[model samples]
Target: MLRIHFAGEDIGRVRIAAGPVPAWEMLLSLHALRGPADHGVFGPWRARTLGVLDASARLLLRLAPPRGYSPDFLTPTADNDIDSLVDAVQSTARRRLRTDLGLLAAQRGPAVWMRPLADGDTTALRCVGTAMFRYHQRVLAPAWDRIHAVVMAERAARVADLLDGGVERMLSRLHPHIRWEAPVLSVTYPVRKELHLGGRGLLLVPSYFCWARPIALRDSGLDPVLVYPANRGLQRLVEPPDTSNGDSLAQLLGATRAAVLQEIGGAEGVTGTDLVRRLRISPASASEHATVLRRAGFIVSHRTANTVWHMPTPLGRAVLERDSGVRAGHGCQRSPARAGFTP
Candidate 1:
């Protein structure tokens, strides 16, 4: 169990990452390669990726074992962009690199190839960066659109929770394995550990590649982040919406109410006031629509101070996802240029 103790100031500091981090995704994808083949969801992706692995990819696999620790230096928090990530790893200070690599070695046995990296050889760092670039382009870039969609959908729900009830409420609903109990957030982990936030707050990062439980940085001294599995619904991402079914749903519920449902799902943490403005409906009408949605279990409304925030429930999101007009957009911004390493 990993227990994270929070302070008073930490309540106001919790944040969710805007999008996926390429460096973190790269390492986590490698770990996914070694996961159980019967997981069903990632089976097809795993087959396709494994067929394309090369020497450079294998070099990374040596350090990021399926079941154990991966050096933290590989994932830099300075920025989330792929280009920045590659640069961060390549330019990592010798001391930090040496320390992280040393920890990796201590956890897993000594590896002869890791010697150069631990010694902070510039060439070895370049090789690491080169591997990351190639692996990302080959493994991640192809399916990025689908991955981005799923993660963004998850983020929207989480952001809504944060807006509705603040950091405490958001933390409580992070995942089944995570429990937020007042001053401490307990997470189920394979090992025992404790982390005191000391008011730096926690960054909640939703990851497509993470499975089972959440993962945290080994070194507690770094900026706190919890990378948890995003709700996949991958098949839904690729399939075309059934407009006929959506139209039927609209008929069953009043057309106006259906529109309200779509609007609630499409918008992140919309309020009754926002609904009134966006839909050009009267305040009472907006409240009525939201109340109906909430009572029917299609949406959840939370009162925050003077305002009440609204978001779709899983069932409501499912209905909206089937509507062609409510298709989710990609969350991660497009990279300015394809990232490359000059090894």
Candidate 2:
């Protein structure tokens, strides 16, 4: 952790002194550390701006989900394939991928700058480069290099690195007011066990479960050209996996109680005349749905005359698969009139 944080002064022995860190803390902290430090430096607003830019860059990638070879790490493999025929075909695959991404970088350079700012204000540009290097050379590059003579995996990394590299180079070209937290803070989050490399995994849940949507995205097995260019590497933080500690769905939102939570477009306090106008449902329909979700413990409802407001519970967040934005069809709930609501 320290070595990664400093990016200097190798402290491999430090691990002996620290002992093994619990998987959870190690993973979450590493993940958090990857976040652009500008947020930590310029305060929340600048940090948020950094986050927004990062999202925009990522969104540009996701708007066009990698539509090639299934990025499915879980794909089933054949038990027996003769190695004799494998060598020639593998070599071909590598060159093809590299060429595709190289072409992409050349064509869409501006849309995909590696880093956000000109100055190397943040370490993500560097760290991500390293991570990409490792995941490629060690993980996929070797296999592809042998199978595809041109080393498709390595080329893909090179192309992505080159394009994003331009962004980093630009950062170096002009210095910006960069920020850093020399000694990092311990921001605890509930994470899976494997993330903890050291045994000191802390058990703490953040008060607010929902944060600005996680930017992770995975290629959904729908593309092929990406396989040729190691650029298949760009991973957008998409929807997170469900939490085990979170409340159960049925317990939170009863079977036939109120409206479905996933369908609620936006009914926070019913203050939005626009929502009323848009939904076009009588005040009764709207209020009833809010009431059901409230009763199911998915939301908290309060009545101020004709206006009723609803806020979600942590349980609702898990079911909605999000705590922040409820894009289109999220957090829907409806109570059967037979079940009853005063509205």
User: Which candidate number maximizes TM-score?
Assistant: 1
Model 1 Cα lDDT, one tens digit per residue, 13-82? 8888877778777878889888876556676678778888778998889878888788888877736677
Tens-place lDDT digits, model 2, residues 1-343: 1111222221121111011111111122223333555433213322333343332234223212232211121111111122211222122233333443344444455334422312232343333233333332332332221222112222222223336644233212111111123322112222211121132211111101012211111222212101111111121122123454243334434432223354442332233243345556566655555544544445443222243334444445444544332333355543353124321
**Can you give the TM-score per candidate against the true fold?**
0.71, 0.19
lDDT of residue 122 for candidate 2: 39
Off by over 4 Å in 1: 232-343
Where is the poorest 10-residue window by lDDT in model 1? 334-343
Residue 334, candidate 2: how far off, in angstroms? 26
